[model samples]
Target: MPKPIEEIQKEVVEEFSDLTDWEEKFQYLIELGEALPSYPEDKKVEEYLVPGCQSRVWLYPKEDSGNLQFLADSDTALTKGLIAILIRVFSDHKPQEIAEASLSFIDEIGLSKFLSISRRNGLNSMVNLLKNYAKNPNV
Candidate 1:
């Protein structure tokens, strides 16, 4: 069974807390990005592309018995790491759970302070898109 979303978020917070500096945090993100499962090449089409992001990003959702799993990739390492975190928190869960997720971990980790305006917007867009998918999984 999957863990509760809040538990996952807290775990993420604890993980980020160990890094003392922004440089270390960034390197950790890069490492997380590098660890993401390889996204399928066939799914890298226009339909899966996430908008509002300067970097090209793709998210593919696979549903199994009402739980939604996301497979994602990005042209940039930071973006990939961001999506990887989202995937960890939101995937393998019911659509309603994902839709209603508070996602407080983003703020808890001070992730926004490190992002540029455009990147922040992109991050918001990504979150919105994930919730939107949860709201309409058939789409």
Candidate 2:
């Protein structure tokens, strides 16, 4: 079996814990965003677009055997980084795990504290959409 969701989330928290300041964390986030796999231009259409974000975010999931592998990208660097973290947490897991996993890691990493209200809303939208994709694989 793949690593447990809690382990994946905890690892993310540990990674964030090593950054002493928000500036460092932000830079780290940008690096994570930059590391995301390239998204196909054709996949950038509305069907894959993540709504309610400060920038455009596109998400697509490919199922291999039983695991859900995600493909995502964002128009803004920060949002891209944010999705990278979410992808790291949720990707390559069963649909039920993706839908049910507690996302307390967001707060644990103090990410919410730095987001603007609109950005927070956007993040929530992203989370909901991710779960929806998991639950409705046909999406």
Candidate 3:
């Protein structure tokens, strides 16, 4: 079995702790975003686009064995990195696991401070969208 979500979150936090400055953190985040799996061109549609983001972000969630698998992308590089962390924390986890989990890593890593007000709103939108997908009964 895969490591528990908490373990994954802890690892992420530890990884971020190594980067002492926000500039290095930002660069690290971009690298993380680059590591994300490719988003399908066909699935990039209006319905999947996350609302309230300054940049265009598309998120697709599929249920597999009661866990949510996500495919996400953004028009902006920084947003891409932000969403990648969200996906890393949420993906391959059960709906209950995702919905109930706390995303304190955002604060722990000082990610929120790095974001502009609009970007933070967009991050919330992305998170809400993911939670909404988890709450779907039909998935």
**lDDT of all predictions:** 0.92, 0.91, 0.88
Q: Give per-residue CA lDDT, model 2, range 1-139, as digits (tens).
A: 7888899999999999999999999899899999999999999999989988878999988898888989999989888999999998888899999989999999999988998898898899999999998988764
Please provide, for model 1 over 1-139, each residue's C-alpha lDDT reduced to its tens digit, 9 standing for 90 to 100: 9999999999999999999998898888888989999999999999999989999999999899889999999999998989889999999999999999998999999989988888888899889989999999994
Q: In model 2, what are the clashing residue pairs, if there are any? A: none
lDDT of 1: 0.92
Which regions of candidate 2 deviate over 4 angstroms?
none
Give the distance in Å from residue 75's predicted Cα in candidate 3 to where it truly belongs: 0.7
Clashes of each: 0, 0, 0
Candidate 3 at 94: error in angstroms? 0.6
Best by TM-score: 1
At residue 47, candidate 3 shows an lDDT of 87
Model 3 global lDDT (CA atoms, 0 to 1)? 0.88
Enumerate residue pairs that collide in model 1: none
Candidate 1 least-lDDT 10 residues: 113-122
- TM-score of every candidate relative to the true structure: 0.97, 0.96, 0.95
